[model samples]
Target: MKGMFNQFGGQFVPENLKNALDELEKEFNTAVNDVSFIKEYEYYLKYYVGRPNPLYYAENISKDLGGAKIYLKREDLNHTGAHKINNAIGQVLLAKRMGKNKVIAETGAGQHGVATATVAAKFGMKCKIFMGAEDIRHQSLNVKKMKLLGAEVVSVTTGTMTLNDAVSEAIKYWVDNVNDTFYIIGSAVGPHPYPTIVKRFQRIIGDETKIQIMEAEGRMPDYIIAPVGGGSNAIGMFAPFIGDENIKLIGVEAAGLGLKTGKHAATITMKQKGVIHGMYSYVLQDKEGNIKDAYSISSGLDYPGVGPEHAFLDETNNAQYVSVTDMEALDAFLYLTKKEGIVPALESAHAVAYTKKLAHTLQKDKIIVVNMSGRGDKDMDTVLKYLE
Candidate 1:
């Protein structure tokens, strides 16, 4: 298979798992080009997952900012309340096409797990989700939703008991059960084909935004912003616009406390090049190359490594990567809630926070689009604690 992401993405898995990766790549390549497969995927996206999600102009927020006009790509309104379902449904359909009867996935914030479980239930496939024990505790509502959707939620206790550990456990499970199970990775940070596959599946966000923005304003926005954990949503929102030189793409990473405090998940800003979780990317690692634990108030953005394509993009300066603090994201969350009445996911709020800052610096005629990747319903408990 061709190298992933301009030499930034490749399979670095155990020797035993090579064939499975190769097979998955082949099947995904074929499936993407097949008309019937595309049609079926589109059908589900429209009828089941609720496609063509609104691109709403945040007039109140824009007026408050008094600078760039802001528009929100409302992925939060999708069936499962997040952009995750876009990739989840696509991967599940691919698994069914490959004749896999069981699916496995890893999630941190539980949006991905819930999405996977939802698709599995709809398709009558057995599903298991690996999540960190800490995430299971903090994101209890999501865990409950997954279980109610008929998926077995496995709590991982290794390492920091968060996203990174859960991902490692999920990959190990896939390696051990490669034949009959399909592993649906939630982010764009996994091995070869996975980063590519997830990006392609989630790219609908950008594709739709491009058309919707053109129709609404008769031109592309000057900036597109989204939060980057493993970078699926940001990459999805940025891919289609990469060729539009006039459009700037900005990815916001989580600065848990602050970048200067050494307690952030700002991979592109603070990490170095290294391999983790079967892909070569910018990783938060020690001098000995050991992966370090990443911290973020938002579970979805608490990852040590970013997607390989994002690493490449940073290296090539094709897009800009920045960080937002927990306090900044919290302020934006409340600001949007009061100003626009939209409770953005904590992950998405990071982007919103940055957009607000950027809008202050730009002219009023300038436009910015923020991908509201998910809703805040799953984050009420966390938010309430922070508010208190």
Candidate 2:
């Protein structure tokens, strides 16, 4: 029960890694409560990662839709160009506190890898970034950035050559080097301590929003929307407001091609309960429990499982989970860039896609917040190919 989201999360790993995980858990618990540790964390957040980015009102898009006024949580403006830096910095600090000299991570869409490399470079830790070969191709810019940040990029050409496989390889490496290496999981998925740890670090997104929104709107927002891949950004943005029943929460998933065509990453929408990458959650598996390869135009959304907490949330209806097609995401990507002069990462575009649809049908007096998770400079090549 210590590691469960109503039967959705657990250890689920081999016996050998349990002690290491336990140690990490103990250290993490101690560090978060230590006043000096928290001060150091907050210091890096303010000066390095740039906290309290912005909650800008998208006045143009709001007026154009003729519906709810919209606000964009500008996570894209954070250093390293995404919200991934929040957890990256936090976990790397834990690694440092543990006296670890190295860090390992798995990434897709490359934002997490870039963020990991950034902090590792800053803290002078040896870093290894395991990424799917396919993602390496699509997200070459971030791969280059990670290399320039002094990380060794390991290319995994395993199953599907995607995020799921990359995660598999990274975990294998952690298993081999568990004694000395600190694994910084990029999302709110993975085994017990990992999900809890990631959320602890990432909750800054929602915590800041609570204070910022009240200052701006003088009350809570009518709704908040964010994309869920392994559920990091979505949970980070939704966790703080979950108990407030007056505010609505929406989690958008990538429906690549279409859900009907069976080529999407809408795990909570289409998958059944099962274990994936050491956590019990909704996974894209068949009757025999064989995980299917998930497809998405956005590399970040191309995962076969939803985070356990997200599966639990979907089951209990604590928040609404919805789907948006890749075409819809592309349209939203272009729309936001043209309308708001801000380019959203393809992953964030899924949330924007659904937000546009919801906002168009709502009354003008309403308010909605969309977490713009990252900038789009790294996706220009993909967008160009589509335009071609």
Candidate 3:
């Protein structure tokens, strides 16, 4: 049966995992609606994870582009240097409430692993992270960070040795340890409640942006842009503005070279409807329905599937999907670093690359808000190798 997001997400998982998902869904519903639970969550967000970061007006970039006044939602300023911390904190807290003393998660660029480890440490819970072997090589810094924060890092050599494989390994592990362990899904993908749960936690980004933009410009932005892998950060930023009829939501996907190159991860733009990671969404697959390998310079953005919500949004014409090549993303990375003096995660750079194109096509008075999802410090190794 099609669950939430209008015939998109459901428990397309094993029967055992379905039971665990049901329990999680019930607990999440109860906890999210409880006053005490929300208060506790907000408390940790402020005192620990640092909520209400900032909506920075990128005057230099805006002037350089000579079009829309660009504003950046500074999620990079959060404690773990990314918006992933928001979901990590929320899911770990839920695990604690459910009497789970250990948590397991899958990560691509390792930001989510680090976030999960940080929260597990703060909450005194045991943590395990599943990461692809190739991703471990590319994102060693974040891997070390996760390990330093007291996590057991498991390397998955299966599949394409990337995000999709890591997710498979984590799910298999969680199914075996379902009673004592909790799975902290990193993005707004996965089964029904997970997408909803992650969206709720991440919606803070857009909620804060709304208020901050109103305070700064006395109105809503004409566009909100964010990079989409499994679509957590983008959906989180888009959820609050979904009802604003005039506001345009754009999700940028990773196009490794060009669409014709057949190596990118532009699932929403180039793929068909299929089940992946226990959810129905747009996926890159062969004629036999086997998932294909997704390649990108950014480890975090090279996923074969889009979040189910993104699939629904694209179909309903509520959001637009675009692709940026790796070269374009790297160029945007250098541009933002030079102009704004802010280093963006390669994942976020994809959105910046699109913004660089879209902003120049619009009027100078039009406003665009880009969710700067993470800092680039963890991507130093990959970026350096690419530069070399």
Poorest stretch of ten by lDDT in candidate 3 = 1-10
Question: What tens digits encode model 3's per-residue C-alpha lDDT throughout 92-183?
Answer: 98999999999999999888999999999999999999999999999999999999999999999998899999999999998899999999
Predicted candidate 1 versus true structure: per-residue lDDT over 44-124, tens digit per residue: 999998999999999999999899999999999999999999999999999999999999999999999999999999999
Question: Native-vs-model 2 lDDT?
Answer: 0.93
Sort the predicted structures by lDDT, highest score first: 1, 3, 2
Write out the backbone clash pairs for model 2: none
Among residues 3 or more apart in sequence or in different chains, the pairs in candidate 3 whose N, CA or C atoms overlap within 3 Å are: none
lDDT of 1: 0.94
Model 2 misplacement above 4 A: none
* Cα lDDT of model 2 by residue, 1-388, tens digit: 4589898988899888999989999999999999999999999999998898999999999999889989999999999999999999899999999999999999999999999999999999999999999999999999999999999999999999999999999999999999999999999999889888888888999999888888898988999999999989888999899868888899999999998898999999985988889999999986788999999999999999988988988888899899999899999999999998999999999999998899989988888999998999999999999989
TM-score of each: 0.99, 0.99, 0.99
Off by over 4 Å in 1: none
